[model samples]
Target: MTVTETSATALHDDAVRTLEGWRTADAGQDRLRRDYLAHLAGHPDGLFRACLPAHITASALVVDPASGRVLLTLHPKVGIWLQMGGHCEPGDPDLAAAALREATEESGIPDLTLLTADGAPTPVMLDRHQVRCTGKDRPENTHLDVQYVALARPGAEALISEESLDLRWFGYDSLPELTDDSVRALVARARELTR
Candidate 1:
């Protein structure tokens, strides 16, 4: 394998190990975790967006516990408020790093701390949904998303990137009405962790 292929393979191995070790009280979360693992096993390119059947994506909810605010990006294509994340790049060292990088790049916030367990970054939830990876209309494939929580420093200013139509912080209790329940649920669970 070439250097790029080797790097991606390493990340794929890391993802399998991470998901295998993750546990949740929620049955649906655990079920999705298994499904993700199976997908990775069945398709070597499961972690890449180019995998058309489905792909393992990483995303993080940027939260400021002290202020009770969560940062969300209005997705340009979906035209709805969502977390900072996308397709896993070949260079991403691991799922958590992919989530962190996406959060930083999209939020323009620095020094965010990932919520962790057992001295390692752990997932807050799993959300599998259909999406058009590109801005084109209609569902293209599934995004089997491994969601994590990121703690943003208080009063961290957010700058919107081209990937987002708009980026803003909303109180945990007052997320945008247009925001879907999955994101709201993510914020609720993230609040529980930060507490």
Candidate 2:
């Protein structure tokens, strides 16, 4: 059965199982992993962005394995270069699929391949950041981002989405100065996987 077709409850349960089984080498990441799991345990709507205060977000680092370049979106809201990804939809079947779906939509690049570990959509890394969407009464919210990597088809063209001010590819070693250390570390881990 397609579990995602059932209900939001299934999604939370699935997230719990996935996080519980994930193993990481980084001490900090392991702590974050536990935090993510705990968040899900406490918030049934944790996977959705509308969950106030904080929520889980899935993101993709679209990498061109043949060219050693990665796609980045200049986020219009945050005014920073970032990977393509955002809040999870109820239709998404799992975390990996959610990341892939977001990547495909934001990147507008077809035939991208999601790199997997042991045949699972295991995340390359996790990032937590604060965001405050513009407009009155929109308070600050925490984004618990689950970052994944995708192999962009060689020579694939990227189209900018409404969510970004610009979309461009940068060499792994040549990422723009506007990006934070989190993005740099994500690129580093993705590089190790691609190599």
Candidate 3:
């Protein structure tokens, strides 16, 4: 199925309504969404345009399954705890798969399931900021995010990578103290979906 069709099938009514509001607010938002879908479908190199006003692209989100606790990476540049995801490289097919792959690579967790493919793409509030890339052949660019959840196996341990200063699990009820408002919003949305 196409990204638009998949998104229509996966998102809940309330989420769809929220998206509609976003669509109405900016005419370009709907076109951007469609363009992103087309880009993901056609680009062999896995590049997409940022929704934000920058020339860079690609991003994702990761979620823990058993306890509904999110494994956040404390980014050294931003110094904020956020999801485990980044640019979709030349190999990634879709955003959801890329998110899962990034989570596993960054967290050292092998058993990650793509929630979006299972008809449950968790809504995530976007965070757009400037940061230098830390990956191999590091390039400076903006990140256009495609965020989603991944169901990690129970009792899995996350091996933090060098990109992150710290890796920790934060309960939904107690997420405020650990991160910024955008991260908290992602956690809240995940909790809403799980419950």
Who wins the lDDT comparison? 1
Segments of candidate 1 deviating more than 4 angstroms: 134-139
Candidate 2: what lDDT?
0.88
Using all chains and alpha carbons, the TM-scores for the candidates as numbered come to 0.97, 0.94, 0.64
The collision pairs in model 3 are none
- What lDDT is reached at residue 137 by model 1? 59
Predicted candidate 3 versus true structure: per-residue lDDT over 60-139, tens digit per residue? 45565567677888877767788787764434544455567778887878877755423554324344445555533555
Model 3 misplaced stretches (Cα beyond 4 Å): 1-61, 117-141, 176-178
Error of 3 at 134 (Å): 8.9
Model 1 lDDT, full chain set: 0.92
Local error of candidate 3 at residue 77 (angstroms): 2.1
Better of 1 and 3 by lDDT: 1
For each candidate, the alpha-carbon lDDT, in order, equals 0.92, 0.88, 0.56
Instruction: Summarize candidate 2's per-residue lDDT along 68-176 as a digit string, tens digits.
Output: 9999999988888999899888888788888999899999997887888888777889999989843336888999998899898888899888888999999999999
Model 1, residue 121: displacement in angstroms?
0.6
Best by TM-score: 1
